[model samples]
Target: MDYIDSICNASASILDMTPAVRKPEEGKVVLDYILDNCAKWPNKIFLTQPMGGDEVLNVTFSEFLSESKKMAAYIESLNLPAPSQIAIMSKNCVWWLMADLAIMMSGHCAVPIYPTLTAETVKYTLEHSESKLLFVGKLDTHPWNEMKKGIPAGMSCVSFPICPSDVSYDKWADLIGDNEEIKEIKKRTPEEMATIIYTSGSTGVPKGVMLSFKNLTDTTFGLINTTHATENDRYLSYLPISHGMERWVGECLPFITGLHVFYAESLTTFVQDLNRCQPTLFLSVPRLWTKFQLGVFKKMPPEKLQKLLKIPFISYLVKKKLLKALGLNHVRYAGSGSAPLPPDLLAWYRSLGLELLEGYGMTENFNYSHMSKPGGGRVGYVGEPSEGVEQRIAADGEIQVKSPGMMMGYFKNEEATKETMTEDGWLRTGDKGELDDAGRLKITGRTKEIFKTSKGKYVAPAPIENQYISNIRIELACVGGRGHQAANAILMLSEDAKKEAAESGGKDAIEKELEELIKTVNSGLDDHEKLQFVAVVNDVWEPENGFLTPTNKIKRARIEEEYNPLMEEWYNSKKKVIWHKW
Candidate 1:
């Protein structure tokens, strides 16, 4: 059977049966639910952050509302262009949410850019939105300055610190000033555009997905049909707010559920924050989940871990201990999306008493589509559709979605917008998938990245690439064989893994060990699926260097471009067996 057939079978065995779907009541907007619920659950924790030397900051629903109101007032006072756009260029932070709500309250649209966005993309976003103000975060100022040339003159720029030279610049503090007489703007129409989230254009210029308040609210509440959230549930907000998954899960869901949200201080402190928060709920992209699984593999050999997992009594004890150690003992609902998840990683986490519900959605729909049941998770598939959304397999197996969360349209690009929507309005997901008799969705490779080798056999890069990176030492993997004789992969090794190998043994010994790793990864694949060459570089793929996303996912296109010059050496030379040849 082909890989898609294999995935379909594998998914059915795990994801086919889940909780009965529950449809949410129609006619609710996210902003309405947030304001109403906040008034009701005033003391419920809304937003949390740590400011003082690694200490975590916690804010209640009342405080979040108050702060949001203050920020709204200041935004209103700005008196810029009417119905203007507010752009937030920052990572995941409490201030990002504050800025989002402030924009909404001021009757404006929000454009949240990815923190790892190229200066060109950033400038494009600002210009595309025709933003009246930029609420710059306390981030590396270099990118802002780099893109300053792209900033439209008279398109006012104000850093969050809102410095002295920043004429009439607004600080977060300005939101809560003594001026309490701010006029109330009417509640947003359900159809009003609330946010414009730019898709991470790992391919090209990022497209702004214009979402209405209704889109978010409907999807979020619809997801709640499968979730059992309470005012007491604790949520960790570590994922980038710019992404629709995080925005809906970390922000929109919290508003309706009244869950406590603790924002991580920074990327370096995320794990520490997770431990400190001990959140009952958490959401992560498959890439990060893969990283964590790799971290675990680094400490314990995969073979040994697999062996230990098989011993019945020992497996129970090991999982219990690991869950308690990771503070995931109380995780009621853990989830992953944005990319396909490796089944091995998914099963390993499930064994640890964590039910990570792998789900699916994209920017256009505000990430409200399908999710696995808490206990009934399907590792390789993003399960059945949620309440109120219809799922259908298109002619070519692309998952077609029609949800209330579907975007208003693509900002500044009407042609692309029309192309994205179906004649009858189903949003084309661009992902290939299959559904079982039970309606669970199993995703195959992306339609875009399926490449052909010299023999004309197709290679679905992600699956093969995921297997290679399972070695723990390989941090980034990009697979391709298009325009080549055979399929090959370029892998960037973990920095620490390289140093560890060198310290433990010599360069030659490490080289041999890496070859063994490649052989092991290759042994599991079919002839066409096996990699012909693997480029294992010792250097790190950093976001600062444009090789990674804000979420630390590899930039496949960029990696391919940078390594195109080395392809001949990697393939033609016998030294290509191990990547150190270059």
Candidate 2:
């Protein structure tokens, strides 16, 4: 049978159950929800932003509505074209949300640019979207200085209170000072465009994903239903809000659920902010999660902690203290996404009584695809399809999905849009995956990332890389084996690991540990998939250096271009672990 026929037969039993749909009121756009909340809870605190140490700015529902209205009025007074595209380039802060609401209120589409993006990318996004205005807020001074050069000299710009003092743009307070609230709030239809979110661009140049009101509402409402979100829940917003995952979970969900959102002040104060908020719902990427685990290990050595956990009474106290220290004590729903989470990490958190869920999605679908449910999770699986989402596997093992939250198309890129969708209207997720009998999905590898070895065997890098990254000493791992005798990996050591390596006899100890780790990892792999060597690189990989994306995803093309030439030399050396510095 053909791929479609096979998919239909395979999913027939799994799809027999009725899928979850959005609530009646959930069909309304985000603006409508904000208005309803203003009427229902005018005095309720909705957003909290940290100004600095021990000082925070809070905005209530009524205050939020008032400020959004005044900003909307100011925007309308400018008399740009109706439904003009406006861009907000800022970090996650209270003004980012206010500016977004104002843009929607003024009958304009919003475009969000990652705060960590380079000047070239920022320029490309603004020019591609044809944005007429820009709002600048909360950014690192150095990146802001760099990104400011990309703004067209003729384009009008507005600055939030937290913006750099040196900027020569019209201040937000000044623009709204004299303008009256708009007489009528412009309401948008479900089909109307809400935002154009650019992808994080791990493989190539970023593409703008055009999302509508319906797309946002469906994903937000679906999450609310699944998580049982309420106004009492608190969320800490630390992830970049420009990405689809954070925008949907941290920003849009609050509009519908009235959840209290606390903005993290800075990296140095992240744990402090988390402790203050004690959020009830938390979302993070695997890298941060690994860091948290390392922090815990630093405080209490793993061997000692394991011994203490053997005692029943001490185990409870240890778990509670650990969660409290991480500011996840009150977290009822914790999610990890954007990259594959190691199963070991999931088990570790679960042992501490945190039900850490693994979710799978893409920007093209507004990040509504699959999410593990409470008490129904299996290790190494991304769980069943999310509410109102339908998924199937193609003949080539690629996973295809259709969801109510799917994007309209790429902005001004019809050819790329066509390449991303199937003839039957499903989004072609480049991920290769399989469905369990219960319809849970497990990703195998990316179609574009698989490479061939000299032995004519195919190698999937992600799974092998996951094995290496599970070691606390390793920070990032990349595997490549195109025309090579065997697959090999490049690893960057964690900060603490690097410090340890600098000490007397430390380098030898680490080399021994890494050799053991390699042996352990190879035991689980097939003959061709086993890594031939582990090369420790001396360089750092970050977004500023063009080695990683703004979302912490590695830039595969750039990394390969820089390192592939040395593969033959490293292989011929016949060393199991080679430190680049040595």
For each candidate, what TM-score against the reference? 0.88, 0.95
Tens digits of per-residue lDDT, candidate 2, 454-493, equal: 9999999998898888889999999987899999888989
Clashes of 2: 0
RMSD of each: 4.7, 5.0
> For each candidate, what is the lDDT?
0.70, 0.86
288, model 1: CA deviation in Å? 3.0
Q: Candidate 2: minimum summed lDDT over ten consecutive residues — where?
A: 1-10
Model 1, span 189-308: residue lDDT tens: 777888888877756677888988878777776766566555677887777777777887778877777777887766677667788778777667666676677667667777887788
State the TM-score for model 1: 0.88
What is the Cα root-mean-square deviation between model 1 and the actual structure?
4.7
Q: Best by lDDT, which number?
A: 2
The prediction achieving the highest TM-score against the true structure is 2
